[model samples]
Target: MKFDSVIMGGGLAGLVAGISLQQAGKSTAIVSMGQNSLHFFSGSFESMTEPPQRVADLFKDAGIGLHYRQGVRLMPLGTFRESAMSLEDIELFPSEKFARRVLIVNFQGYHDFFSSFLAEGLEKKGMRCRIRLINIPDIDPTHQGPGEMRSVQIARTMDRIWEKVVQEIRLLLKDEDAVILPQVFGLQDISVPGRIRQALPAKVVFVGTMPPSVPGVRTQMLLKKRYQLLGGTYLMGDEAIKAHVHEGVVHSVVTRNLDSHYLEASNFILATGGLFSKGLVSNPFQLYEPVFGLDVEFAEDRNTWYNPAFKEDQPYMGYGVKADDTLHAIIDGKPLENLYAIGSILGATHPELGSGAGLAINSALVAVDQILSEK
Candidate 1:
């Protein structure tokens, strides 16, 4: 199969680039290995720095809705984390929409959420809130025999007990300002929060739990739907295993599922995530870009790769495939004329800086711009 552009990885970066390219009248295809990184998303876009109007507009064009907010995430462990944007269902910190006294709810056996933890954070942020634990004695919410409860599992079955939860909330809520719930809404239902909120008298807030996040999955589905609506081809359950590069251009990519069937394209994009997602691989000696063998920048000394402190600046987070000003992927110290690297795969994109979503979107757009310009 042939396309105008082929994007490897269907995460936020790859999808954004594919959507932009398709919108620009390019026949684009995204080869992905099952689900994307949004499965780990917190339902909030973390950014230390916000993007410009143009950059923000790209998401609008793609139909992924975001509520830009100047707020922070109230962590359960007692901390205020700054946030830039969030899904409409999520509640940012210090929201005036809620009253002074709030009631936070969690499940009895569900360990993923702790009302006290978040209440502590809220208190530190100068917000008064109460904790309520709703018991689920009839059913086992645990994933694997008395272990921690999974948000994804709970989210799937939440609708069954929706009315029960609402009733409990009403009983527990006594003139409280708002109601905070663990993000166990249905996996694909963004309207669940709205439904609960409408059913209740006060405001309803959804705090992100561990992945696979319902909101994150919903975001992924929304973007994927928009991409399909725009005629972008998405090849799920398949990944680009081999890039047929020659003469400084990527001729095609061959996926493991399609050994001989080449996905030929005029231009290519590499948005596969960094080491965590195996976009860049490493051995004992050195690090290398998995696809196309492009030049990557990372620490040579394994000892200095990480710092002892978890919150401290880890040097390895700054490593990725090296790209030029035009976002073209570099191989053997020369730029690949037709291949560009974007998102977390691009070097100098530090997640700790807290601008990952913005950087990914911006880089995707920039790479799409490069492809458009070169055309």
Candidate 2:
């Protein structure tokens, strides 16, 4: 049977495409290594805090187009609302409304000001807020995991600290029943693939603003488990060795350190992000492609893309497929007939906007609708 779609990369962008397409009555398969940058940073879902017009103008200045309507109100600091309708009404927010006490944990002292500031404003509205400093290093992938900062000990200490934090919050609410909401990293075992037949703790949901690497790894493990349970397959640790494409179409994918696998798909989506996430980075020699032999539009000089100043955010970090208004990958200046590209893998069209995560998921949602509509 031909698959409805095959998405590469399992992060928010890939998962969004997979989940959305599957829900739309399509069989979708997502291929990924299971690690996502979303866990390394604060997981904040952003809607334009400004008005729609102003938001449009702001994104316009940064070169991103507003494909859908802007959201009116904000969700919690770390959650993503599926659509504008859910965000327009504050009453629809899933989190409890007006909790008296809150916990703020900063392992590296660099919690998102956007979320932190909003939490402070909530405190002024008579919510008692407590901020704790975990003193972990700043967020960086290379310096991740419990071993880096002895985060294992830190995670162990949280159970006791959380008790105190909750007690203080209860007092502030003027009731003993008030409980502390922890902002520190906590552990939960999650189920992952291969061991899917039996329930296992594969994913680790991070409870804090900036989760340490251990939690991030655990999160991926959980997703791998869940993805497999949902009938998805993954080729991990092994890199894509070759793509057998003929006449502008992908035929099959072969991986080195492994064996050959044939895939027949009616449609395909490339969610393999850019250099940072290894979507485009497939080998030690550093060749960038979608693993399916897709033609990529890129800078003449690779150095011209990345921001040189270590302190500055990489101005050239956003690079991938150059898509037309339909979000289809444009190869050799032409859109692939049945292929779509979403997420950070899409090129510099929206670089400075920092809207990649939300836009990627939202755009894929839009693309899935468009794809199904065409069928």
Candidate 3:
């Protein structure tokens, strides 16, 4: 198969890149190895603690509509910590107005979320909050423990009995200003929250937790749908295993599935993500970019890779392929003529901030702009 542009990795960056190029009348293809970290998405996009003015414009041009908010919001997870959440599918009440009565809804047998913990944190923050645990027998028939059940399972089961759940919530939320729920809405049900809000008297907000992220999956699906609508080809459940390079230029890439197939492209964008996604690998002493053997920037001594304090920022988080201002991957101190890198793959930021999605989206836009300008 051949395309004008081929994107590696189907994460936020790769999908955005595909959409941008396809909308520009370029024939694009996205080679993905199944789902990316959107399964663990934190329900928001973070560009920085304070994103720039251009970030909004960039998102608009990329056809990604996100609810832009400033500053950080406390994610309702273990210990209730502060994280950046720029975009939200549901309506998020401002922190100041959140002093009203709040009801946190949790599903029975779904151990990924702890409503009590979030309620306590909100109470400590001076918000009048309480917990309401709804026992949805259909969601977990066997009463599986936390380790046994996945977030996706609960979300799917919830979809099967959504009307009942909504009716129960309507009764439980009397006089409450807002309803906070675990990210357990259906996988593709982006309209469910809005529908619930319209049916209920209070506002609705979905908080993110660990893996099998509902919001993350929604975002990924939204991006993929938009990309396909713009005539981008998506090769799902396939991986780009090798690149046919000639004199530092990647002429084509080989993907693996049932059979080995090649995709030829004039331009390539690598957004396979960092060590977590296996885009960059590391040993005791050296870091390696597995696919193309691209140059990686890391501390020589492994001891400097991590801080003595576990909670402190680690050096390894900032390690990734170095890129030029045009978003081209830099190898041997020179930029690859036809290859560009974006998202977590080209890094100098802390992963703890959960800002990779925003960075990925913005970098994808920049990379596409450069690609089109050069054409």
Candidate 4:
């Protein structure tokens, strides 16, 4: 089946692209493989207003323009905001006051408040809150029940632990939730799965990271049910293979679910995320571009990308793929048109001040408007 736009990767960025396109009356499909990164998130998206000192220096060194601020208010992708967003297609922005001020829940480390408590807060504020989580294991990965941590061992051993985290974050971003705050180290940008062409006419498949999450299993189930009701398409289970790109245009995506399956689409969005999301990086040696042979602009040295010690908790870890102000994919001093990249894939700035996702949305809003205007 042909789609007006084919989105590769189904993490938060991909989901937003799909939903926005569908709402725009465009035939859109999401090609995904393996687990999504939204599952293990805190469901609070932050548009970093402040960088952690050293990170600010790195952005300065990189010559990137970023502003540190309090949490900006969030609106849908089409709504107008004072500083952050414009009256563009699907205008949206994340709120800093809402994201940072709220009580957070960390299952692995233990914070405070679960879904029920947050629900109560939303009620008290008279603002509806969306409760969605995705860092949970599925029947295919777990044979044991929820109580057994061993049941999640498959995910832990298979690099699925982070995928679960991203899936939850993705859902929160898409569902108009409070905000998505994932504890995962970073994001990944994998290829679009080959499952978009396989979706049944009346069915919606969710291509997200699967594997059980800590105390988030119930939420994942509910999200799956609701996504189908919304007519989504997904390609979960296993990693996505390389994408089919010609002259800077992605035509099809191949995945690793059953040896190999090919899926095709028209226009595509690369939302596999950054190095951590596996949407852009391929190897630990710091190779980039997991799908379609897209060029990834990374630091000159891997050590420059991260602090020598993991304990440093440096925000410089957020880096990959450089683009110009137009948000076009750039490589070898040329911009690739018909190809718009967003989210963690951008190398212009780090998450130090926490504007990584916010900048992504801003860039996406910019790109979407350009696309719509051209239409």
Candidate 5:
């Protein structure tokens, strides 16, 4: 199939670019290898260093509504806590009122989250918190190991028995002002929280945990739905195996799944992510971009890739494909006119410091603007 633009990744960057381009009346397609990092989303965009003032507008342009609050908010997981520059909209009890008393709920067999830890952290933050446990009869008898039970699995199970869980929550929330839940609200139903809110007096907030992220999954589904609604083609569960290039411009990308298929486009955006997504790889010698063979900037000595302190950012975290001022990939100081690199695949950004999403969104805006300008 052919389009005006083919986005090579289905993560935040690719989805943003696809939505922007498609909104600009360009025919676009997103070829992805199933779901991306959203499954681990923490219900917040951690753009501490460079908060995007246009975040609300970007989502609004895509027809995805979200609430944003400036300044850092403490995100608690178990007993640990971290900070995010901004938080997306969440349903809170007292229905828009500050939660003076918060009830944290956990499932007995769900190992993905612990209420006690969150309660402790929230208490430390000077919030009044209490812990409540709900035992779902169907889940207890399954005999699944902790590792075998993922957030998605529990979410699906909870969704199937939602009425029963809701009744139980109604009983537990009698005295609570708000309830904090693990991210197992629902997969595609963005209105789940709102529905729950209507049924109860307390506010419901879904916070994500380790892997198989609930909030991240929600954002992914929301963006993909908006993209498709805008007439953008979405090919899920496919991996780009080869790039057909000529004179430094990527003409098309070949994807492999059940069979090989070629996707031709007038322009390409490589949002294929960094080390985690294997967009960039390292051999015994040096780091290199795997798909299009774009040049990567890295320290020559492998010993310099890591620091002695584990908590500190590693050198390899900043290694990615080099991009020019227009956000296109640069090979040996020459720009690949039709090929742009966005998101975690570009070099010198520290995602560990909470600026990853902002960088991705801002760069995507720049890339799409450049594409429209050239057209």
Candidate 6:
């Protein structure tokens, strides 16, 4: 198959690049290995610097509904850290000051949330809070431990237990300025928080649960839908295995699922993500880009890769493929004119705070710009 551009990896970077390219009237295809980072998203688009306006607009226009609040966002532990933007219903404050009195709703036996731990952070902020627990049997039908119930699991049965939860919280509501709930609303339901807020006088906010969170998956799937709507071909559940690189450019790539049929494109993007995600892999004392084997940038001595202190930022976080001024992936110390690398796999991000979602988004936009500008 042929396309204007073939992007490897279907994470946030690949999706954004694909959507932007399609919007520019360029045929784009994304070969995704598996789930993207959004599966573990922390409910915030964080950045050390202000996020580009296009980043906010991308979410707003894609129907995810963005709020350009460049202030603190609710961390999993309930502490607030500055972020460029957050989901419409997240437990975020415009500044460090939060509501003095708040109600925290915890689903009975939900393990991902720790009321005491969360309360600690809130207490540090000088807030008065109450813990309210509600039981929902649908979440654990087999009578197994509810501790295993992740956010996505809660979301699957959320529709069945939605009203019950709403009413239960209603009874617990008192003189609380805000209600903090686990982000277990519908998979695509961004209105649950708002609806609950309407029922109670208190503002409703959501804190993300474990992996495959309702909000994370919701955002991931929704953005994917937007890509499909824009006519971008998504090769989901497939991975690129071999790149047909000729001279300085990549002409085609073969995937594990489509080994025989070569997927060709005029340009290619490698966005498979960093070492943890396996976009960039390490062997012995060296690191390698899994696909296309583009040149990578990292510390020469592996000892410097990590900090002895686990709490400190690790050097490996900033290591990734070598790219030039235009974000073109460097192969054999030379820029590959048709191959651009973006996002986590492009690394060296070294974000000051949060998960670097803004950095990833900005890189994707920059990559798309470079691709369309090509002859």
The candidate that wins on lDDT is: 6
Residue 196 CA displacement from its true place in model 6, Å: 1.4
For every candidate in turn, the CA RMSD to the true structure comes to 3.2, 11.1, 3.5, 15.5, 4.0, 2.4
Per-candidate Cα lDDT values, in order, are: 0.78, 0.49, 0.76, 0.45, 0.74, 0.79
| TM-score, one value per model | 0.89, 0.58, 0.87, 0.52, 0.84, 0.93
Tens-digit lDDT string for candidate 1 (1-375): 999999999998998888778778899999888766788787667562455676567667654566776776655464656676777676776553235777988887887776777787677656788888887643365443554367877776785667778988888888787788888885666567778988999878787776677778877887888899999988888878888888898899999888899999889999898777788888988888877899888877888888989899678778888788888888999999999888888747434323466667778888888889883
Candidate 6 lDDT by residue in tens digits, 82-103: 7756677765577755787888
Off by over 4 Å in 2: 46-161, 164-182, 185-239, 256-258, 282-287, 293-295, 301-303, 306-310, 350-354
Alpha carbon lDDT of residue 165, candidate 3? Answer: 82
Give the runs in model 5 whose Cα sits over 4 Å from its true position.
48-63, 71-102, 126-129, 138-148, 160-163, 173-178, 198-203, 257-261, 349-354
User: What RMSD value applies to candidate 3?
Assistant: 3.5
lDDT of 2 by residue, 72-163 (tens): 22233533344332111122223333345555434442333234664655565565655544332333223554343344344444433444
Q: Give lDDT tens digits, candidate 4, residues 1-375.
A: 456766666655565555555545666656666455445432223453343453344323322224543233222221213443211111123432332222222233212214445445444545454544443444222443334333133323323344454444444453342342221211211111112112211111121122333212322333333333346565555455766666766666666763545666655666677666776754557656656555566566656766778768554445666555655666556666666676767644533313544554455555555566664
- The TM-score obtained by model 6 is 0.93
Write model 3 residue lDDT over 107-174, tens digit each, in one string. Answer: 76777777877787777767788788887767664765556567777776666667888888887876
List candidate 1 stretches off by more than 4 Å.
48-63, 94-100, 125-129, 136-149, 159-161, 349-354
RMSD of 5: 4.0
Q: Give me the runs in candidate 6 sitting further than 4 Å from their true place.
A: 48-54, 140-148, 349-355
How does model 1 fare in lDDT?
0.78
By TM-score, is 4 or 6 better? 6
Candidate with top TM-score is 6
